[model samples]
Target chain A: MSTFGLWHYWVVIVLMMIGLYTVIARDNLVKKVMGLNLFQVSVIMFYVSMGKVEGGTAPIIPEQASGPVVYSNPLPHVLMLTAIVVGIATTAMALSLVVRIRETYGTTEEDEIRKLDRAEHE
Target chain B: MTFPIEAIVFLFLLATALAVTHLRDLFAAAMVFGVFSLLSAGLFTLMDAVDVAFTEAAVGAGISTVLILSTLALTDPREHQQPVRFAPVAVVLLVGAALVYGTLDMPYYGDPTAPIHKHVAPEYIEGAMTDFGIPNIVTNVLASYRGYDTLGETTVVLTATVGVMLLLGGLGGARHRGDAEVVEAAGDEEPTPMDRVQVARVSTTVLAPLIMLFGLYVQFHGDFGPGGGFQAGVIFASALILHGIVFGLSSLKRVVSPRFLEIGLAAGVLIYAGTGVASLFRDGTFLDYAVLDHHSAQHGRHLGILLVEAGVGITVTCAMVLIFFFFAGRRAAKSEEPGDRDRRVA
Candidate 1:
């Protein structure tokens, strides 16, 4: 396999990096959640890409096909389906936490919340 | 070579991810994130992972976007100003570089001899018809061979729901407070009169039931197609959410009470665990459904898979609906609290 064949993985990696950057750099709690979601989704893409066969079709068995059919590996898809649901669950939980933070701190900014906490402690 | 549709889609995904990161307006960012999910789903389909694509489309593109928008409604949409931080950038780059370096050792795309392809995946593909009698090998592997992992995943979802409820205050626990105050507050301050929109009402009324029907199809059709309990649950929840969006949260609550949903959340988990225990009664190992029926092992496995999948569907649907209710309720309560906005300004 040539380097060109691995272009998909490289692009997915770049997306993952962008998502990671957003999660780390962004101040808004919601944006951070969004960033985390992007990072997760890119990871899912990478896994699915690995499961792809060069000339394979979808994993579903056809009714009338007579010849041997190359079905893409279904294991990664199965695992990633679980991951996607888990991702949504986590995102919902995170967003709810953000809502609570906003309500309690009167702000969603991480730094402001920290400062408020410091003042309260003092 | 033909037009690189996958490459184009990947580029779109990258561009959308960047846009979502840089966009200041949270609402626009949420919309862009929806597009990002849609494009990723497209990419998943292109890669022949149709089940994942369906799930991504429903949960990622549909429900998450709505949830975020609802969150936006409750909180401020504008982001706070922050100075450029170099440390995070450096860390992200370092980790990303490490990940890239790691991928170099992985087998090339879809090589039949790849380690993953040579493992249990082939067994699933070859033995699905004989062992599980299911056409969809993905379903066979997920429901039977990997039944324990899926059970764990369901528990994780249930745990997350409990955490959300604990943080946001369970709806059943808070119901006695009289949501009248919250509803009145939302009415006064909410910018859009979404409930009063005739088109939304008409469209949702017409579409909601159809979505529920599709959800059912996806649920039972898992043995043959690219769907199962997870996708079905999200679709079902999305239908309820759409109804809530058009008819108002209060109406939705009256129709499907929080207490019922809360019970449902636990009941689904119980059902899943119960199936495993039931198998034990038949002198089978935990979650071993082959002994579920005496006549045939395949028949027993089918029954077991169906019951467990239904359990998963019920739990997921209830969890999602309950979470939405809690978030919406919290937002409403916050809006009603006097001097809340003033505190932020000060």
Candidate 2:
């Protein structure tokens, strides 16, 4: 593939990395969830990008077209819709877990939670 | 080569992602993330994924942002100062490089001969109109050809809501707290006074019903347009969420009733699964709508899709609303702690 052909994927890669970095590096639980959201959304963008046809319009079949229409693939779009919903569901669950963790540990920072866990064990 | 709109959207998305990462205030991060979702929705539109864009706009930008902001109500808005961690950065770099390298072998953007397009996608695109007489191929494939996957997805949504309910305690338990305590707790817990504004109340009053109507349109119009059960469910949930935000959780619970929501959640999943089982008893395969109408198989498919879509819409809507209720309830309960409130205010 040419350089122009691959730039989109590369940008998505950078985005995914940023999200991953945030999730791993952030001490706050909510920030971690936000990072996870970003990661998943970047992946969605990658899939949607691949489905785009050069000169194609939206995949909805026109009612009165005399010739074959160039339409972007709809499969990825359908799949990504499921992914998006699942992402939200998972994020909701994660946030709830964070709430419970806060209730128990009295802190949302990962390092403090870890410290508290170690103290309890010791 | 001409510039594509995707590049511009991606740039904005990248900037937003970075801002979300660097912002110490969780509230600002959440808002920036909403902007990020909106940009991605715009990009999805540019990519000709209108349904996904509509969904991203509603669910990602609208509901998730609201949920995250509500979550911030329970937790501290300021992120703790931590030293930059090198290990995660190194790991991220390695993984990102691997992904980039992997993409080298992938088909170029919009290449008609890409492997994804060469496979069953073409079959669905060509067969959708002939088999189901649905103009929107995505809906046809989601509800008919790949009905089982959608069914599984509905179940997942139901399962998540159940998990949230368990985490936040039973619906009946939440209701028994009474309105007075809930009102007081909401007043104590909520970070924003905006919910109390007359303007917000009036606007939400005007908009909630219209939003629900649009949700219905999206639900039934899936056959002809870029919407279906999933989008409709989120939109419907967003309506209730808006009401809850402006009118307070107590009023919303009074209107929706947690017990009714719980029933709605299960009913949605059962409706979806039952449709498939019904098809089986009629000597058709699971989720086969062709047997629904003996006169015309197309009509059967249409009926089956509509019923199953309704089931999906119901479950998703109920699940989202239930989750929000539990989250908000938990926040109210947490804020009731006298000592915790002092620390939270600080």
Candidate 2 colliding pairs, count: 0
Candidate 2 per-residue C-alpha lDDT over B67-94 given as tens digits, one digit per residue, 9 for 90 to 100: 8987888777899888888999999999
TM-score of model 1 (CA atoms) = 0.94
lDDT of 1 by residue, B149-265 (tens): 899999999999888877666335554453444443444444356856788888888999999999999999988888888999999999997877677677777678777898898
For every candidate in turn, the CA RMSD to the true structure comes to: 3.0, 3.3
Q: Give the lDDT of residue B340 in candidate 1.
A: 60
Residue lDDT tens for model 1, A4-71? 76677888889999989988888889999998998998889889988988788878887776899899
- TM-score for each prediction? 0.94, 0.93
Docking class of 2: medium
> Which residue pairs collide, candidate 1?
none
Model 1's CAPRI class? medium
* DockQ of candidate 1 against the true complex: 0.69
User: Per-prediction count of colliding residue pairs?
Assistant: 0, 0
Q: For each candidate, what is the lDDT?
A: 0.84, 0.84
